[model samples]
Target chain A: MLSQTRYRMLYLIGLGLGDAEDVTCKGLKIIKNAKRVYLEAYTSILTVGKEALEEFYGRSVILADRDMVEQHSDVILEDAEKEDIAFLVVGDPFGATTHSDLVLRAAERNIKYRVVHNASIMNAVGCCGLQLYNFGETVSIVFWTETWRPNSFYDKISQNRKHKLHTLCLLDIKVKEQTIENMMRGRPIYEPPRFMTVSQAASQLLEIVEDQKDSDKESLAYTAETICVGLARVGTDSQVIKVATLKQMTSLDLGRPLHSFIITGHLHPLEVDMLRQFTDDQSILA
Target chain B: MLSQTRYRMLYLIGLGLGDAEDVTCKGLKIIKNAKRVYLEAYTSILTVGKEALEEFYGRSVILADRDMVEQHSDVILEDAEKEDIAFLVVGDPFGATTHSDLVLRAAERNIKYRVVHNASIMNAVGCCGLQLYNFGETVSIVFWTETWRPNSFYDKISQNRKHKLHTLCLLDIKVKEQTIENMMRGRPIYEPPRFMTVSQAASQLLEIVEDQKDSDKESLAYTAETICVGLARVGTDSQVIKVATLKQMTSLDLGRPLHSFIITGHLHPLEVDMLRQFTDDQSILA
Candidate 1:
């Protein structure tokens, strides 16, 4: 074994947006040496399961579910202070706000940490031909409830459109969430929340636009006729990108859970040409 | 060897946002197997050099510089009818307009194509604590000339701020560009162009804002006191992210090239906390 400072150290590896081998060269080195490897599960999930990652890395991984992180952070953080620990996250470490919070907590405890970065969905969404710099604020579209429907995203889209910038919509993901009743009862009951699909999000957005029209808002949000791009399984083998109007997208079955949408504002000529190749109907450009 | 199909074929592989290892699992497979590998060189550069990639992948990469792609498309498109040709781009293949043009050209020639996605700077900028969905149009700030200074980006920034959306400012990179004399002479003479630094960009932007303030456009595009995040070597091991006011950033030395700036608009409580950790002076937040 190497000396205290000469041995291995804590490694925060970013499992690329898709699968197990998506791990980079530096990430692979740390994983191979880690005494205890934990996959942070709440932020995101790989297309392949934990078994697939185990086969590729040749190591057993502890599933650090939300409960583990929230309740037992000391377990992961403590070991890192003295010995080598690897806490893995799907996508880059800073991709999610939760991971940033975790890093801050570790820093407060004077734990030395190294972040091994990987491809994230934020930059990966550029596969649609939109200029990364031309993109405006990104927003998440969540499943609206009868009581909890919110239209604030409408203002954001409107603002992006006003400047002719692209808006990347990260669909909502719900993992290991509990219902209000289950929390109050203090039972271990949990409900599986739905991941927002592009189709569902578009339908909701159209309704909100119509509502804005009815309420006489000064600016129009977006119509069913507005051109949008729907992307599914972005970094995987079965990835799909389709460009169409909101009405046209309503009928698109992109397949599977992780889906995202892009509502174009004013498009550069190059952007229009790029989006046209992905669509079945070119009339969206018209 | 895999037999060549009767149909024309084009394989697009994303180089991720930074280095060669940033390639997706699917992308690496295609690049290794393809008959010809062409690197699209104009749009962006990986943080690491091409030689570093050549050493890692164990393959000779042909540079498809702008002149080669624009003036010699036949070289890339010719073998597509008989062999699988891979065109590698920094970031997702479709992240830039030039690659989109190549894809459209392939489609016109009835070529079958597959795009392997990787991360782009678009989504990677989220590491700075800005919400992906809350960003407004991303703009490119170019190196200004005394005779031809343009401030069109000012309008876009102003509009985004009014709506409380973050603006990602992609600094300009000018590689392998020619001078007016060289173009007129029809010779291969070239003039080195400038890559805009974050500090230089901030100073120019402040100048534009001052100019705009004097004009009828009284609305502030961005002020010297406005908070901004300067990011350098984003995806590399030495990546640095700093949050400071424009005035402060103008004087600080970030070191190295390929820098970007983010002019912040609105801040969520969580974003405020995250960015505060990277802020130059805590007193600025107060």
Candidate 2:
């Protein structure tokens, strides 16, 4: 049972996307009694802040940034062996590979761990009216700089389209990262967090399409007029879903970070009807 | 806001993948005060029975079978126009297309609806340590009869394997279904519910593999020794994850219903290490 009193176990709880109240009842009960509660802050973000979670949970939450989690997770494990430690994740605990690594670390130290599952973008993308079963492999679109521009995601999208399957694009997030120069100089300064918006991702994808068209027109997967979906602040009250063309997506602003995009391949009539509800221009559906 | 007292709303809540406590705090609050509560049956099953949920939420729950949800949904929508109603699903509300149809129905009747999302097998399959992003299109395996033996899922598995992407196979659940004779006779008799076990799925898949080998050796996707991951009772205290070959899977029995299988395509070193922990025979990893 989860309520075993004698055994002090580590609970990797999932705080479902949205406000503080999104946490499961079982997770909340564990958080209230845990000796130390740490929130993983890099991979994703909730609509609410740490203070809001503290207010609802009646416990102070420690923010475990990328450094603390990747470099000094031993400190987190040390306490978990003696006392019940709550390591909270914004979505499902296993959504990120790093959390799986934490499980491995805890296993190495003979520390027992339990996972509390909750909703994440991997499944919640169905909110846009697309069937989750029809989606192919999910890809990530990172922020590209002048010196480095990677287009590997384009090939995956093209493959998915070839199979008449949809693709979910997880936009990148840069949190608590250091500048290359600062990292080289051993400086502790960190850059402000930046989230890749849908417009930014659409712009990048358009460039890939342009390059592909010039090289091999027959191999192009999507064009400027292809339908694309943009969702922002999913699982929250301000959630927005917009259906438009790739060019239209480049001009569309979803109003906030934590956005995702979907490139469509085949749409059923029901899916088209559902997508029509979120589209501002019915001409796109036509 | 969800707490708006003046507006009567219909809430489609997700009762995660496990027991009663898996429901989000936001969902529990709505269930506590809802005038009428319905639990969807047939698509999935929870580890705990309906009595456990009623005892925890302090409300009597009505079991809404497929007929009630698909045909008599207008009755469910009728009351939501004047009172708060809660329709609880075994997983996330949007996991099934039926729920999406309900949303469209609610829209047609001018009844406001809100969805409280939670974990479903689509995302909770990550418990097996296969990265969620690496999964391709999900496929369903139905109970095959002597006359109707379908093998179309093999092609999809082959496609995913070609892309080096994993495939999540959802086992079929036959609940409250009538026999052909009973349906033809207009009798109300029903067959006992049957949940497809991992062993049954593996046996069926092995048959498909044998057929493929005989007809076209080049088109075969997986052999008998292909790695398959089986998970039973996920998100519960007795959750089980097992990694074995397709032949080995036919001999392994994971207790209880709602079993899922994964066909591995490409495994990262970390994924291999994580999977090794679940595998009984180390030689599989080797």
Candidate 3:
């Protein structure tokens, strides 16, 4: 009890990439001692629910959505000056830049902070049999709209492919977002959360290929037949991995949200063997 | 006890990046039930020693060096066909390619295996405030000999810089490596383990710059004044991070092994601010 009361600091604990049991013993101990525990929920999602975490830790957890985290972060850190405040995040705390912003804000406020590291998607993608060392710049594929289609990620992917390096594409996740019309009227209403599926990302990527072909601009980095690896619910028991061409992936369903897509470059013999477990197309390896 | 006896599979558990307490509750539970626990020791080093991990988990741990992992892996897996065998790895299990080879070997032998993910340097380097998404292909800087100096890593760095993407340079670790003379005599003797320090890596990199300058073959990707980040023993309490120029890093000494170097590319305003806390040279940020 004395150890708990003496230290009044901000703890940014990573929940790893799985269920409640995935929390490190060090992180779990701190969670038990913290006066307040806030689970940041906008950037990522865990496989388990809040009740599962609460049941495992035997502590109450407050879900901090985007508005609460982005706009009212001060409230999250208000009591850190006098008591331990646990700020929990899915995967590693620094996996997303938003958590770093929170850490910097705490530093600006003169509050001490501690980060408990855990497995993040950046490293867990290695489970797909691709070497992490060969991965180049990672890109994010956002949900495309009628007028707002972004393809800068395609250029980055091309750059990586030119160097024979893999590219990790993080799918879009829209949470607590509002429609343009609702926002214009100053409404706080929100749309249902949307987690991009692997098929959607593959389709969007194929569209980019078509767009480039129609315009006949610079030569494309990858074609429709280029190899791709799609990962779903990584780090859980129900995790799924599929390997095929980009065209084949457009119809492949991985059965969950929180999906990640990898557009591979050259594969080593060992990597090719590892990927063989997930795909039936043997000729692609040839 | 029945639950332990029911599962006779192989478990590849990640010890995370810190002390023994960093093991996930799920992993810890598996370790507790394991009939035999082997800690893979060659690819990486942990902050604490074998006794610390053994005491924490209440299990006797066997150190599995490169010889044991590579030459005698069948011996390590002999009992996995009938009992729970916990193979522990520092950082994430898949951080190193060697672990993947072991998994592949197990699959070939018809031994079922499960991977427990944890934080690895690939993602944990984000603690230094460089966004993970901005990183390009990761390269390794091995110790250079007079006649065997390899500069291919330089070309990769140049490629990454062309895209204004940061490069993560993984410093080399030589464990139980035999000297050329000893190997010629068929001796089993070993050299002292050498872990590359930031200053040593910086000096080697400077030599590359000098070689390129003298030959005038290809322009250097980075100069002595380019901003670099040096991280040592990340995910630990006494972890050290320094942000400075490659020239300054040549003289900088952040103690201990397991060092990682970063050659930064373009920096955003927030990234500049995040790097400010580690360096005193404000002019570089300008």
Candidate 4:
């Protein structure tokens, strides 16, 4: 019972949102000692590059794309039979929700694994002074096209409003997403990855509201005058957060990829006090 | 422009869910260099005592009770004008949601502060194998009394169920709470701290249904047969998780103060597969 089992172990470590310093001390120690380290590159993007992480940890990190992680994961789990292999993720190891798949596969194979946890945007959004508990279901806003545009996220936002709960909209990120025609031809042709900014997200949201307007009494969900908060590069020193009306969000520039938008619900006095700090016009609340 | 403002700094550090090792490297570095460190003691509980943390950090930590933190915080924020001071929190600094108050105060007073993030139970609940994104609003289940049993959380769970989302129920903890009569006497007659357990939570939930029953099938939203997962001491080496029917949970014992439970709505195949590992007989599905 003492030492009989194989030492094959996998460490899925979370490098918190901003930079390399965001990685937890326990995670960093393991990264320095592990035989191999893999940085998950598809779900979310870290503001810094792999070189930055390598310089900080004093080790070379292999980048694991979606294909490698979803398809060829056997290679990553193989050598773990004798040593620890660390798979680093940009936020909490469970941040992207899909990370659970990796944990499942590892568990299916009986490979010992431990998750090193860190801050994810889901929790860090509290920086905006919104109570995390007050938020309802979180929805992702995806990029739209001529014929494939979808507005299902609007319904979730509406339902959250009915419950008087805030809604956190996670903007879609397309990394290594293949074009439809290229996929049909079995070619590797890929479109440059696109990140949906808060401005674009607001426009799409408004478009849906416009489409659904029969007499335009504001849909009882959200309107051009409803309050929305836009955040970009959260957790970074240069992070930006601003509050504005839905119409104003279309023209505001918070900057950068990985933008998040929130539609607020009934406001508590403290929440109002906090949001006042980020509102464009101080007279709105005064 | 840079040298004009005072250099007073306050660091609100997150000591992750478990014991001392859960503190992030950035947080630990700040703790080591700070002149005084305060551990917030009321909002949540750490599995370990202050001495354990002090021993691990090679420094002394002052326990900041609710009164000290909420009313007498000026004492903790005092020395920061001339030296660095760290305020440590039991989960992510924002996990309690109320920490934002301190941040607002610091900002209002022109006291520069930074938050060193770590894992909170909200994200760490992903270990139960539910897709974290599918989770709806988190609700707190407080201890009930003869005339004070609140049914608000029931409605929230119902709303989440209607949306086909999982609900993370954060059981309440009573730390340093005093009796109303004793409080009026101007004496701090502290009641021994109480932590709500999964069994007690389940019973109180069922009682609510029984009271509302005219000819009830499952008016409480969750029935005796509803699927429930209970977790104790999450993120620690001795963490325990078990799955059972709501009826079965009333008798099951998962030890320790920090416990969490999930009331599932629609279950994905992956979720069912993952939860199967924790079921006692493995015949719940078969």
Using TM-score as the measure, the top candidate is 2
Q: Is candidate 2 or candidate 4 better by DockQ?
A: 2
Clashing pairs in 3: none
DockQ of each: 0.40, 0.73, 0.63, 0.52
TM-score of model number 1 = 0.89
What digit string (tens of lDDT, one per residue) describes model 2 on residues A63-180? 9988788889898887787899999998898763347788888889989888899988888888888999989989999999998999899889999999989999999999889999
Per-model TM-score versus the true fold: 0.89, 0.97, 0.95, 0.94
- Fnat of the models, one by one? 0.47, 0.71, 0.78, 0.54
* Candidate 3 chain B, run of 10 with poorest lDDT: B1-10
Q: TM-score of the candidate numbered 3? A: 0.95
* TM-score for chain B of each model, two decimals: 0.92, 0.96, 0.94, 0.94
Give the per-residue lDDT of model 1 (tens digit) for B1-286.
Answer: 0233345488887776656666755566667777888888777887778788788778878999887887777788877977889998886665433366677688778777766655556656777777766677777788888898877788888887887878888888898778888888888876675677778988988887676666655467678888899998776656788899988888766777668889998887778877887876987677
DockQ of 1: 0.40
lDDT of 3 by residue, B1-286 (tens): 1243454778888898878999999999999988899999888888899999999999799999888887888978987889889999999988754487788888889888888899988899998898999888899999898888887889889888878889999898998899989999999999998999999999999877876676544467998888999999898877899999999999999998789999998897888888987896888778
Q: Tens digits of per-residue lDDT for model 4 on A12-115? A: 88888887878876788788888899999888887889998899899899999989999999888887867889999988887645476777788888888877
Better of 3 and 4 by TM-score: 3
Whole-model Cα lDDT of every candidate shown, in order: 0.76, 0.89, 0.88, 0.83
Q: How would the docking of model 1 be graded?
A: acceptable
- Displacement of residue A175 (Cα, Å) in model 4 is 1.2
Task: Rank the candidate models, highest lDDT first.
Answer: 2, 3, 4, 1
